[model samples]
Target: MKSLIENPKDVKELRENGILFSRLGSDEEVVELFKEIDTYGLGSRYVFPDVKMRIEEHCNSKAKTWMAELIHTYFRSPWTAVALFAATFLLCLTFLQTFYTIRPAN
Candidate 1:
């Protein structure tokens, strides 16, 4: 499919092709559409589409598992992932120490 950004003037055509504005639309056009809507004096607002935000939101909303979502959030920052691994290792080490101790017996 052609990119909506590549066809800013063909907003209606995109809609006809089953591309909703929510799924695809130019930011400037969206702003203009909101302006037009405001010109009609309707109490509404429009949020410009952001590709990165849309991707993250989709991942968060459609994730089948909480772990998947958590991993996605953690990996968004490299430091968070590193910290997660370190904390997990520390916790496991503590558990191992408590459970598997070498005892000196008579």
Candidate 2:
């Protein structure tokens, strides 16, 4: 490209550079994206051409490994997820209903 951008003075300068920006979840869409320039949008040009990344992330291998393990365990047996959720929900509902409460006598 022809140095599409330089030290942008403001939104106006950014527009002239053909690089529009917007929030990642603003629902502005690709067409409406360039119409507005936001410094708060998530930018991942590979996945979302209209998204503008305005935040930084710091991570460690521990979290990555945990997430990977969780995903693998979840999909490996979807029934496990369903059963676990159902069991937990039923337990909460039962507790709320007090279905097993013992009556006290005077």
Candidate 3:
């Protein structure tokens, strides 16, 4: 947590999300607190090792990374997602119609 916070804004975001609460005067105080905690050099034991491993695995997966990137790049907007769905539906309908036209009637 100490390593994750680089500035007061990071502390403010954590506070806003209820991940952190400080009785200190400002977000800067929280940042300073983290820095102070970092100097203590906590031991090697991690609180959530399993969760950290799972997150690392997810971040390392190539297919999932590519799919996430694709969605982030092309489907950032709702309208783009809707258009892709509409286009896929039209394509499937076109393929079905073509197949029916080519086959003999029962």
Candidate 4:
């Protein structure tokens, strides 16, 4: 956690997300606290090994990563999302019209 917080903005984001709470003074104080804390003697002990392993597995999955990238790229804005929906609808309508035109009617 200390390594992750490099500046006051990082501290502010963590505090906004309820991940960090400090009554010392401000976000800068929280950053300073993390900086001053000594983590050299912390013994190696698994607090939640299973949860960590599950998170690692999820991160390693290619399908999940691809899906996340797809969403982030195409659905980041409302206009892009609407454009994708309209394109898909048009393609489906084109396919149906082609099928009806090629079919023999009684």
Candidate 5:
């Protein structure tokens, strides 16, 4: 099945990164395919799904959104969240204690 890409320039960008357009043949054929794909807004026609899938897998493997990752990790383990909160609270309390305890010499 044919896939789709959101950007046409991604073809040239991928090729510039040493990706060969094997299905489309040599540099000349690849250039022609690129133009056709660009005109039609079908970048995937020249690029392979494997590249897209690999990118997706890599992105999915990491925490793209730090908030989403925090929610997942913290919410999944409520104890850890509570511990982190407690640690933060303790640090704030310590800072306040030190500020109040250290009076300026008259």
Candidate 6:
């Protein structure tokens, strides 16, 4: 099948980044990348839209309100949500630190 990208510049960039449609290992991966950044398939099934929708759903709410709403909806309460966010942030920080701190598998 032909490539899905519409822009010549982006197409060139994808090839340079080794991110072309055929280069993608699976059809699902091709379909689930960003439309603007990906430019490879029918458009992402997730990722970008979810981020945008999340942002839009909150509309003009403040950052703290947004976080609290997110926490209350998916979590239980404001406190729990804050705790969860902190835990996740710390977990990611530790994981990233460990990942980078590794001395390369020599």
Which candidate achieves the best TM-score against the true structure? Answer: 3
lDDT of 2 by residue, 1-106 (tens): 1122223333344544455664455332433444455445445323432222321121235776688679787757888889889999999998866754654344
lDDT of 3: 0.79
Per-model root-mean-square deviation over C-alphas: 12.0, 13.7, 6.0, 6.4, 12.2, 19.6
TM-score of each: 0.35, 0.33, 0.58, 0.54, 0.34, 0.27
lDDT of 3 by residue, 17-98 (tens): 5788899999988887877774455654464567656756876899998998899899999999899999999999999999
lDDT of 1 by residue, 18-75 (tens): 5555543554575355344432543323233365356447546754557766877768
Query: Which scores better on TM-score, 5 or 6?
Result: 5
Which tens-of-lDDT digit does each residue in 1-106 have in candidate 4? 7665768986876687577888888888888887787768654344456765675688689999899899988789899989989999999999999998999577
Error (Å) of candidate 6 at residue 14 is 54
Clashing pairs in 1: none
Backbone Cα, N, C clashes tallied per candidate:
0, 5, 0, 0, 0, 0
**What is the alpha-carbon lDDT for the whole of candidate 2?**
0.49
Ten contiguous residues with the weakest lDDT in model 5: 1-10
Candidate 5 runs further than 4 Å off: 1-64, 104-106
Tell me the whole-model lDDT of each prediction, alpha carbons only: 0.54, 0.49, 0.79, 0.78, 0.60, 0.58
Report the Cα lDDT for candidate 4: 0.78
Instruction: In angstroms, give how far residue 76 of model 4 lies from its true place.
Output: 0.9
lDDT string for model 6 (1-106, tens) is: 1233434554554565566645666444544443335445545444365654554556456886788677668877577769888999999999988987885555
Candidate 3 residue spans exceeding 4 A from truth: 1-32, 35-44
